[model samples]
Target: MRVAILAVQGAFIEHRKKLESLGAECIELRKKEDLEQPFDGLILPGGESTVQGKLLRELEMYDSLKEKIESGMPVLATCAGLILLAEHLSNDEHVYFGTLPVTVRRNAYGRQLGSFHTDAEVKGIGEVPMTFIRAPYIETADEQVQVLAHVDDRIVAVQYGAQIGLSFHPELDADSRIHEKFLGLIADCIKNNNCRKN
Candidate 1:
């Protein structure tokens, strides 16, 4: 399977390395031209949501990427990526993709010093390592969205259809289960012929 990692900004390289280790072809989506290639899934890594959103539009890749995602392309969005996909933000007025019916609170865990790591049982995936660095957590989700995992009563992971949004960075860990689970999602799409373009 091939996956496109948005490298415009943030911790994208780590995701690429993880996906690569799982035997998936990884592509970096940096410019609009990079979208020309066929990819089975997309990964929106952790980063500053506002900056990523601005760059996506300014680089003219926002519309096309949004279109693909809306067309049922499976996505694994982490940290700020969760912010990007949310339809609502608890503190911000701007919404990026607005594809997932979730409401997230940016920096809900305080600043960088608040960063932490822990092992949590992700529904359907068991316990896995989760690293949060100035991350945002989901405050509320539509009825259709499934809550995957939580920490200290705070929602940290959620799945809505073909998209999975996590408030923690899974790529920074040694475990590949999270990334593997994502590939399984893509594999399912392929088997069911539900993949968008590839």
Candidate 2:
């Protein structure tokens, strides 16, 4: 299985390493042309949402990527990725992809000092390591969104359709369950021949 990681900025390298460790062909998506390669899934890693958003449009990859996500492509969006996929940002005026039906509060945990680590239970994946760094939590999930995990009474993980948004950095830790679960989604897509063509 092949997976693409948004490499415009942030901790994308960690995600690539995690996905590769699971035996998936990992590709760094830095430009529009990278989308030409067929991928079973996409990982939008944790990063500065504003920067990634700016780079996506500057590189002319925003619309196409959004279209793919909206087209039922299985995606694992983490941290800033959660913000990117959210339909609304409670405190911010900008919306990136806005494909997932969730409202996010950017840096809701606070600034850099707000960063911390903890173990949380994901609905389908059980308890796992969650590393949050200036992360944003889902303030409100729409009717169609499934609340997967919570920390300190805040929504930290959610699954909407084939896409999953996480507030913590699963790739930054030793646990592979989260990525494995996402990979399972990709395998299902492949098994059902639902993967979109490049």
Candidate 3:
């Protein structure tokens, strides 16, 4: 299996290393052409959404990624990556791609000093230590989406079809289960598609 990790200035290297350890071919995607290339799955690493959005626009990949994701390209987005996949804005006027049908409030957890780590019971992954740094929360989810985990009654992880959005950075931890689960999802998508073709 091959996975593309968006290397637009974030903790992408961490994610890439974790995914690679899972026995998958890892590719760092920097330019628009990278997104166009074939891959079993893609991961959008956490970073400043505004900055990443600008880069996406400059590379002319905003629309192309939107189209590819719609065609069942599985994506795993964390923190600022979650913002990139959000559909509803926080009213703070921060730019977003509005990809997933999720309502996000940027930095709803407070500032950098308010960063905290907690144990979240992600549905498929069980209990795992989650790192939250000025992370946003999923306030609302469309009917088609299924929430995976929550903390303090606030949604932190969600899955919408082929996409997984998280307010915490799973790659920051030593656990590779989350990354493995994602690969499984990508494999499932591919298998289903091949079955349809056959």
Cα lDDT tens digits for candidate 3, 126-190 = 99989988888999999889999999999999998889999999998887788888999889988
Global CA lDDT computed for model 2 = 0.92
Better of 2 and 3 by TM-score: 2
Residue-by-residue lDDT tens digits, candidate 1, 89-190: 999999999999999999898865479999999999899999999989999999999999999999999999999999999999999998988999999999
**Considering every candidate listed, which one attains the maximal lDDT?**
1
Residue-level lDDT of model 2, residues 69-120, one tens digit each, is 9888899999999999999999999999999999999999766548899998
lDDT of each: 0.94, 0.92, 0.84
Model 1 regions lying over 4 Å from their true place? none
TM-score per model over all chains: 0.98, 0.97, 0.93
> Candidate 3: minimum summed lDDT over ten consecutive residues — where?
189-198
Task: List per-candidate RMSD values in Å.
Answer: 1.1, 1.0, 2.6
> On a 0 to 100 scale, what is the lDDT of residue 149 in model 3?
98
